[model samples]
Target: MDIPSNHSNHDALWLPFTANRQFRSTPRMLVSAHGMYYKDDRGHDVLDGCAGLWCVNAGHTRPRIVEAVQKTVATLDFAPAFQMGHPLAFEAADRVARLAPGNLNHVFFCNSGSEAGDSALKIALAYQRLRGEGTRTRLIGRERGYHGVGFGGISVGGISGNRKLYGTMLGGVDHLPHTLDLERNAFSRGQPEHGAELADALERIVTLHDASTIAAVIVEPMAGSTGVLPAPKGYLKRLRDICTKHGILLIFDEVITGFGRLGASFAAEKYGIVPDIMTVAKGITNGTVPMGANIVSDTVFDAFMQGPPEAIDLPHGYTYTAHPIACAAAIATLDTYAEEHLFERAAALTPYFEDAAHSLRGLPNVVDIRNEGLVAGIELAPRDAKTTRAYEIFDRAFHEGVLLRYTGDIVAVSPPLIVEKAEIDRIFETIGRLIRQVA
Candidate 1:
């Protein structure tokens, strides 16, 4: 294959969440992608094992999504989301509401997961005030949780690294203990058996701050960016009950687990519990055009509806709130999911995926293997007193024709729902082979 000449300088662009100096020296540039593979600048096909950071659930370059975006962009590129209206925007919101669980039938669109996180936080606060609970201003997040980079998200988020760089985020935020008990749950498939009682940490926070001061509690049903930490068994339900008993809204940051990453429509569906507010992005448009939405339950919506019929309900939104291009892409993406039955496909393949993930348990540097649905995390022992082993393994695997994502010391693999059994084997086999060679 002939290599495409890359003449552009990489100095101008500052990549997010990346080591700029280290990455500029040797960049891993993907020129294009299709189906389950990404073609690097060097013209090598790298199997996508992380679903392009857990967003591209419907594979890559789907013709339907592409055509819809192209057609919509030509017809109407930009549409104001403030007071004006567009047909596609309403259509997309209705489609998303249809897929959302329980009474989560109201949708507010934004541009990305970060915006969704911040938007959800604001909505929670606004709803509390609307309901005459103006004292409920505090937000609760769990340690090791990854919301996003926005001020509100970082405040409620518990990942220290994400929070430390920006001193003192939104005030009155407390955290519940994360439920990753490695001693009892390591190498476990699906939800772990231990740490369900960890949900009580929220109760402790409520007691300390008083329930009236707490507005909402946000968590990822399965924490994704924090290294694939699945919620402990009964933990989600217990949290749901607590939030209910205290009259605090529960928000699930489903940016990573939404749109069938969990072999169901959403983590809410998989766990059989409903959250008052849910934030979703990424797979909403199959990682095509950027889009995110905060889905609110009917109760929350009804609270806002009591004001004036023509008055502004919530004074928040993005200029590109429901961009026509994103709306088009999302509609097509939803169509693709329904027609392909990708959620059902992922459900059927979970057992095979689980077995393949756990098969790496005895690998040289692997300390733990956890799998749930199509998502898996292989925790590696650190090297040279640092978390370098998984990073090296990630680089090596990319060269070996597979792409993986490493967070801290965990290698997370969550392939597209359309992935085949052969592709699954190839991904783990490549990782397993390269892991054995790690020093």
Candidate 2:
């Protein structure tokens, strides 16, 4: 593999979700990746702790996925998703629908998780209108939720920083309080014992605006980007019950938790509760190719089919909606998960992963440690300056030959599902050592 020639220059490109000036001054570049390790620009092996932004569940550069993408691009690179049809698209959508829980048997393709959010919101609104409930235009989200960065997503998303700079967002968006109760549920393993009552906040919101005006409620079953906050026991079921009673749609943004992150095929399966709609990305193609999708229930699809036999049902879709190569990559990714039994692998590793995570409980600056399945978040006491402690730990961990993700004051870990027991030990062990060193 050839490295980019301009290794020293960082002026032309502006990075996303990064401190541009700080990063340009001290860049940490990944040149290649394999299995659970990434080779940096200096050729140092850095143990992957975040699965390439929580996507590459099957590990890096699997031969089967590579072959699929290669064969696809060489044969049919692009296909017009509008009116024109492609075999791989149908095949990929079918595979995803089959993996989805409950009656979510229909799939709509998009470019990324952000697009998936926007597409799901549109589907909810459209589904309501098609059912003669055009008044149901309101959407509900939860505080601290990270639903990607689209206009529609940002509007309903409750992260203030992500929404502050961008003037007024969409109207009729309300947020339920976040479920993270550090004072009451800190350092608890798996789902915290408290906070199930927090789900009732939706009922309050529903009463404020009336359920007839609310179209859907979107949330991450296991909130990832805003720090790993798994839903409390019974919290999701309560939300599902509320949405069902009100005839409101429920959308689960499973971009990070989808494809075996939560010890099951999806978080819906892990909790035994099904959502009205599901948005997925990241692991759908095992991070080898860019793809996202919105899977809806049969009721939503059938409602759109009622207008006319030849009429265009939903007035939405992307140009690259099911690109042949993406479909091929997705098909191969599903095959990889099944053949390797990675979902079961994740479930089996939870106990060991939990113990390793909790072992850091007494480390300096460690305030909270949350773990579920293969994901864990170690929250540090914030420095006088916000985010300073977390960034320091992140930078130090990278230099010490391990890659970790830092969001706000929390250091998150979610290695590939293909990770071995030894690799898991190394990941948490390195983080524990780094935390002590920072002390």
lDDT per residue, candidate 1, 123-152, as tens digits? 999999998999999999989988889999
Which clashing pairs does model 1 show? none
TM-score of 1: 0.97
For all predictions, the C-alpha RMSD in Å is: 3.2, 2.6
> What is the model-wide C-alpha lDDT for candidate 1?
0.92
Model 1 segments more than 4 A misplaced: 1-8, 385-387
The per-prediction tally of clashing pairs is 0, 0
lDDT of 2 at 359: 96
Q: For each candidate, what TM-score against the reference? A: 0.97, 0.97
| Predicted candidate 1, C-alpha RMSD | 3.2
Backbone clashes counted, model 2: 0
